[model samples]
Every structure is written in C-alpha cells, then in structure tokens.
Target: MRIYEKVHLVVATPGRILDLIEKGVAKVNNCRVVCLDEADKLLGHDFKGMLDRLISNLPERRQILLYSATFPLTVEYFMKRHMKTPYEVNLMDELTLKGITQYYAFVQERQKVHCLNTLFTKLQINQSIIFCNSTQRVELLAKKITELGYSCYYIHAKMAQTHRNRVFHDFRAGLCRNLVCSDLFTRGIDIQAVNMAETYLHRIGRSGRFGHLGIAINLITYDDRFLLHRIEGELGTEIKPIPKVRIPNLCIRCRNNSIMSWTRWSLKASCIPDKRSLQLRLLI
Candidate 1:
C-alpha cells in the first residue's frame, strides 16, 4: 500500500474521478502535478460541483495545468481561481501552416450532399471526414453517401462506446475512407492521411492538423453566417468566400419569375421620378 502512493493514476471521466475520491480509491491531498485535459469541457457548469469538490481536497501548493484547444469563459474563471500566477501560452498565432487551403461556399442546406458529391468527384479526395452538427444528421448523411456508391462510416455520441471504438479503429486502418461524424471526433481522433474535410460552422478545426497539406471545404448557409463570423473573430482569421461560378439553370422548378419580377419592377420605379407609378406599384 505504501509503494502504491508513488504510482501515477489516471481517471478518464469526471463522474469516475468523483466516485474514486469518495470511495477513497484516489487521494488528491498529496498530488503535486494535476493535469486537467479538455479543461474547457471539464469546467462546464455540469461538472462545476464535481470540480469544486475535487479542488477542495487537493493540496494548495500543487501545480495545476489546464489544457484545452478552445478555452471558454468558465474554464478561464477556473484557472483564475485555482492557478497561482500561471503564465498563459497562446500558440495559435504562431502555429502557421502553409499546407492547408481553406475555402468556404455559401450553399443551401438542401444542396449540401450534392455539392459534396460534386467536390469529391472533382477533387478525388481519397480520405476525408464530413462533420455535421448533430448525430441524426451524421447518420442520415452517411447513409445517403453510402447509397451513392461511396464507402462511408459514421460516429456520434449516441453510439455505444464499443461501437465508436470499432468505427475509429476501422477509420485508422483505412478500411473506411470517408468518415461522417459530429463534434465527437474533432479533438482527439488522429487520422494522419486525411486529404480533405467538409463541415459546417465550428467543426472546421478537425482538418489541416500537424501542418499536413489538407483542404477544408466549409458548406455554409446564410443562417450559419453569424456563427462563421464568431469563429473567425475567435481565430483572428477570416475565411474568404469562394466565388460562385454561374451555372445554367435547367430545372423547371426554378423558372418561377415572381420574385425577380417584383425586384426588377421595384428597382425601376424607385429610380423613376413618377410618384404615381410608384404609388400604384405599392398599392398592387
């Protein structure tokens, strides 16, 4: 029992950590180096009570290391309260990568899959991950892509841990070339040969890792512009919009000219000095 005190311990989950602490399986009183990985997630309000309980039991003079890819306000507060005059290291600005070419396209939600398919055919991306915002969408999109004669696998938080492990193993072994997932794979999953990535909003961070030459294609809609703007502000980098090439309209459904007619008439009357014509147009 005395020799066990010198061994390093690891507890993966907050609940498990608290349970160990309560059961006297782990002792925090003598801990000299405490590392909180994914500190932003660990410092969420959902884990606040557990963290407080853990901190209350730790030695006051111990060093606390908080590591996170994205720091939230709650995590910052936790550092201030717990850490003693720690120096901040921000490497994001210095971490430059020349290999990745990031591009964004303003696409409608309905056209996302079609646009992805077009990109796959044009670019011939051998390995990629398509990130979606939700688990249901991940499954739906994976099914759709697989049905289209592409091999795709999906992972999400809703899946059992064993299933997720199997999917990740298959992905790493190159048994599956395309992976469709939610934010679950954004941080820790390491697939070194990913040639391209497609995602919406905040999940774009999954690509271009370790200075590898990668292409990140963001399929954004007008509704996601605000989110994109916020992410740009956080990263201190603007994602330039891709210039859309005009495509010939072939669909009968797109032939409705009511909206265009209204716009053209409104603009013409607005430029004209005929107040009566404008009034008539407004009345109509």
Candidate 2:
C-alpha cells in the first residue's frame, strides 16, 4: 500500500501497534481497512492477547484482510470471531514453487558445516543464508565459516535490534556473501536472488520466497528424518532425500591428542571417543 502511495499506511508489530492505537499514532475508530500478514504467527499464543486487545478496540465497521502462508486451527478461530461473511481464499491447494529445487542430504550435525562448505564450493553460490535453530550454533558456524575463508556474519533474536538491522543491511548490500541466522530471518526479511539456502528442519521455512529461483539444501540426519517427514506431511509435498556423501577427514589442531574415533551420522563426520557423548551433544 505504501508503494502504491496509499493514504495513511501504519505498519508495526502487534504489541507496538496496539500501543500506537492507544497513543494515537493510528486511530482504530477511523481505520477503514486492516491487513494482517502472517496472521497465523501473529495470532499465536504470544500475540493472541495483543490481537484480542486490538480487535476489541477496533471500530465495528471496517474491512479486515488476514493473510498467512500457513493456516492452522487457531487462525481459523480468530477469523471466525473477527470477520463477518469473510471470503475464504485457500491458496494452499494451489501454492507451488516452480523455480526452487529442494534437496535433502542425510548428514551428522558435526559435518553440517563441512557439507555446507563443500556445497558452497561446488555451486559457487553468490549469496546465501545458513539457518540454525539456536544463537550459539549460529555464532559457532559463522566463526568456523569465516575461519575457512568465507565472508560470513550471523544474527539472532538475542542481539540488540540495532545490531540485527546493521547485519541485515550489510547482507542485503552484498557486503557479506553468507549469513548464519536463527528463525528470525525465515519470515519477513527479503533478500533478492538468494542462490542457496543451507538449513536444518526448523529453518527449511526460509527458502524459495515469492517465486524466486533458489535451492534449499537441507543437511539432515537419521534422527532428523522423523521431523522432516512431519514437515513434508504438513506441506503436502515430498522432500526427496539426497544421497549422502562421506566427508573427508581434516587434521585436528587440539593439543590433547586422545585418539579420536570417527563416526558418520547425517552427512557429517565427528571424531568422538564415545557414542554417549555424541548422543548427549545431539540432544543439546
């Protein structure tokens, strides 16, 4: 709407939007139209109360449009409660990504970085985002990738808002070729021509945005197959498992040379003295 030079476009987070309405940044009484993008996420437990408050304050006569990529039962309830004779647009049946290639590689957690490095070298992807489930892993992967001579940066929800903005800005400007991030980058953030996306099950939601030509390469493990299956079931699509390739061993620089025995789990190789420790690490 702002791009079309529409009158009075106020975009904000659900909580802040409510605050603004109360403080007069926007007038709910005067609002002729209300649009909620990613309505399912916005209507989740975290923002449900805020949504309720906002809806309670909204004027009786107003058009509300709720848009979501994925709609579960909660979103449906919210719509039935707030919308009068709402038009149901079920795009899930028609939704398709023609330009994106989805491939899964069964590799271990430790070898994910190595597999990613191999893929990056093989594809020579100009720009990419590596999504991790946690901030600590993002930081560790970014550091390792940088040490391996790749220009990489990482951002997570725990970081200051200003820092996240700067990191995103730099990434968009092509100052960095690779980004390691949590689910924060999976939804709203848009970067053009992302040639590649390397992620796990949780982060698979980030790729193939807006019909762009992209490749989503997931490094999965035997343990991750169940989660991947659940995602495929939810999406009503087949996530093809790619043939796993053995990662060549690299010399360790650790001072303690306690003979490290190697094991392969997804496509990653780890040198561990015991399997119990590896299982514990994976659980963590």
Candidate 3:
C-alpha cells in the first residue's frame, strides 16, 4: 500500500476561505504562506474580523505578507496582532505614478456625459477603465458609454462574484475596449494594454501599470473641487489643464463661440469656476 499526503494551493476571498475552513473543507493548520493584497482594505472594519479568524487557524510558524499601495492606520492593528518584526518595502516616495499624465475637466453635472463623449473621441485610448463612485453610477455610465457606440462592460462589488470575474477576465483579454467599474476594481488589477483611465477616485493607478506609459483623465464637477485639491496635495504631484480645445459646431452654448479654452489653471491650487464656465485642469 502506498500513502500520499495531499497538498493544495488555494486563492480565495477571506470570507469564502473562512467559510470553507468552518465547514471543515479547508485545512489551514499546515498552511505555510498567507498573502493579503490591498492590506488596508482587508484590515478595515468590514473584513478585519474574518481575516483575524482566518489567520488564527494557520500555523504559528507560517509566513504572512501584506501588500498595498497605501497602508493606512487601519493596517497597524493587524500588523501588531499577527506579525513579528515585519519588514516593509515602499517603492514609492510619491503617491502618483510618474508614467501617468493626470488631467481634469471641469464640467457641470449634466455635461459630464457630454464631456466624456468628447474625450472618447479625442483621446487615443487602447483600453480604458472608467471608475464611478458607486455601483449605481457604474451601471449608468456603462450604459451611456455603450449608447455612445463604444464597446463597454461594467463591474462592481454588488455584482455576483462569478459575473464580476467573467467581466474582469473578458476585459483583460481584450474583449472590450472600455470597462466601467467602481472602487471594487481599484487595487491589484494589472492590464498592460490599458493606456488610459477615467476615475473620480485616486485609483488612476489602474493605468500606467507595471511601468507602462498611460494617462489618467478625471471629470471634475463643482462638488469635487475640494477633493481634487486634496488629492494633489496628498499625492505631491501637480494636475494641469489641457491646452485650448476648439469645439467646432458642438453647440456647447458658450459666449465665445464654441471655442472653449482652459485658463488660469494652477499647480498649487485648483481653480473651480462657477458652473457656467468650462475649464480644463491638468495635473502633472
């Protein structure tokens, strides 16, 4: 008779993995290595308990690794509890990526879709990821993009895991030119073909990934004025305005014909004019 010891490698969400452990389907007693991506989010209030429980089931001699672009205060608790003199390697001295050119267009809430349409026509996008603030917005924006005669797909945290995985896989495989998603896809998505990203959040990291050249375009409204400035200060980078854009026969209803110019943009501050004026802001 021959006896064999089975060894398994599993990659799963903390909740799913914990469920399998609870059901006696997964044995982590001999687990050698546990790696957590987006460590800040996992250590947040929502998943911290489950992650703690999962770690408790692993062997005491196991190696633990935490990885994230930003390590917030939330991760301190987990490190203190689980790690013994852990080492951290921070490759970024600044928050923003050097390979990414950041820009923002100030538009009214209603004109956002129109502005985005213009950008789609103007920018040379290979594969782009558009990020919305909420799941509802993700769906709505995806619909609008599709209506604009573009190939698009949408994903969010609220969607089924299987569906989201399929959408992500298809998008990465070049099945779609654009993907509309929420912050759910912000971290750990590496698509080299993505040369442009439109985001309201600081998730512009989606582009310029793996040391590739890319651009990040943000659609800013009056409400997002403070946020734009705060991000600049935090990232220690400048966002600048795009050069003059000549909107020919676009019927934007501006006083100076259809020609819209970006003026008085600042590196130290964001000049958010009233809703009536259209200005483009750029961050470099």
Candidate 4:
C-alpha cells in the first residue's frame, strides 16, 4: 500500500473515501485542501449522507473549493450549510471558450452512422472522444468505427473497473486514436442541470483541455433541435451547420506549432432553427 502519510493528493468518490476514513486508512483532519469536484452531484440527495459525514470530519481551517460545471441551488444549499462567505465564479455565465469550436450535423437516423464514418475518413484526428447517451450505443458505435478501420475503443459504467482502467491508460498512452464513451468518462451529473444549455460546454470541454484547441461535433436529427437551441442560448455561441462550416478538418488548436492545416470537409444537411419551437426546458 502507498503510504498515506506521504500522500499529498487523494482522488476518490465520496462513499469510498468515507469508508477509507472510517477504517483509518485515510485521514483528513490535517488536510489543507478539500475540493469537491462536480460538487453539484456530490451535494445531491443521493450522496447527502456520505457527503455530510465526510465534510464533518474535514479540518476546520482548510481551503474548501467546490467546482461544478453548473451550479444548481442544491449546491447553494450545501454551501450555506457548510461554507463561509463562498465566492461564486460564474465564468461560463459570462464568457465562452475560444479554444474549442462546436458544430452539429443534422442527419437522418439512418444516415448518422455514415456521416460519422465520413468524418473519420476525412479528419486527421490527433485524438477525440465521441459521447453517446447509452452504453449500448457506445459499444455498437465502437464496433462500427473499428470495422471501418479507425483506431477506437470504448468505456461505459457497466464495464469492470479493471477493464475501464486499462482503457483509460491505453487512451492516455495514445494507443487509441478515438474513444467512444457513454458519458461515463465525462464529469457532471446525468440528471437535469439548472438548464441543459451548458451541457455542450461541459461535454465539449473534455477536448481542448489545458488551453489546447478542440472540436466537438454533435449528430442531431429532428429530435435534438430543441435541446440544441437551449445550448446555443446558454453559450450565446452559434453552432455552425456542417454544410456552411468553414473548416474542412478539426484542427483548431490555438497553440499550434506547425500542425495547423485546413481541409475541405463539407457535408450538406439542414438543421434550420425554428424560432417558434425554441423552447427551453428544465432550466431553473
């Protein structure tokens, strides 16, 4: 076992960390920093008991930072219960990331796969992650992409921890060119946020990390128009349609060192926003 005394950092889910603390395998009273990442989810009702127990044992004078993609009122409730004079940094509320470019492809349900395949064949991907809403789709998409000769792999909540660990390691090592995920690898809650508009901001954030450039493309049909509009309103940035998009490839890195090249990747499809149908939902 790694010596806990010498360990300066520990990353764990609340329930497991609470168990470790209860068994004296981990101690937090002397800890100087306690960060609740995706703290909105941590402070949710599902984790209320474990979170309460963990926070109760933390050192009183420590720096407690709560980070979340979107701060919901439940998080505010937890802050009132525990923190003193917490400062709110609503960065996303006021600004958009210039590092990443977002786009959407409107394809028929039957044509989505072909469009995705078309993307892979054209772009010179350094690495990219594709998210699906379901584990079954993650597996099926990974299979289809692999069969098309793209170097790809997948991860989801249902996979065993050991296998998931291996996949993560492989991805970081650059053994894989693309990853198909079910949002299991992404942070933030699967539940409703204050509004769903920032969903793309956080989801696309997985790319262009550490101040690098990234691109996010969503495959949407008629079913996703409303959700897409809400996302646009939230970011105040328009997601360009694939047909009228200026870039032929996904190389948007701002800190480029001669790896910047553009190609013509045009796919003609239509996703006209119907102003009358742009209804925002689940956004408080």
Per-residue lDDT of candidate 3, residues 1-284 (tens digit): 11133556677889998998899878789898999986777776678599889988999898999987776556776888899999989974434465566777777778877877776655445567777778898899889989999999999999999999999889888898888888777665556566441132247654433444456767777687787787676556676654454423322223333432332221111221233222221221
Misplaced by over 4 Å in model 3 are 1-39, 42-67, 72-86, 91-96, 196-202, 245-284
For each candidate, the alpha-carbon lDDT, in order, equals 0.62, 0.63, 0.66, 0.63
Order the candidates by TM-score, highest first — what do you get? 1, 4, 3, 2
Model 2 weakest lDDT span, ten residues long: 275-284
Query: Which stretches of candidate 2 lie above 4 Å from their native place?
Result: 1-37, 42-67, 77-85, 88-96, 195-212, 244-284
Could you estimate the TM-score for every candidate?
Answer: 0.62, 0.58, 0.59, 0.60
Write candidate 4's Cα lDDT for 58-163 as tens digits: 8778678998886656777788888889888875432234545566777797886787777655554456677777899889988987988888888899999999
Q: Where is the poorest 10-residue window by lDDT in model 1?
A: 275-284
Candidate 1 C-alpha lDDT tens digits along 62-175: 888887666655776787888878888875442232334456778888988887777655443547788787888989999998988999999999999999999998887879
lDDT at residue 15 of model 1 (Cα atoms): 78
Model 2 per-residue lDDT tens digits across residues 25-83 = 55567777888887877887779688878978878888899887666667778888888
Any residue pairs clashing in model 4, and if so which?
A: 248-263, 248-265
How does model 2 fare in lDDT?
0.63
Clashing pairs in 1: none
Error of 3 at 243 (Å): 3.0
Measured on C-alpha atoms, candidate 3 has an lDDT of 0.66
C-alpha-based local distance difference test score of model 4: 0.63
Question: Model 4 residue 212 lDDT?
Answer: 44
The numbered model that scores best in TM-score is 1
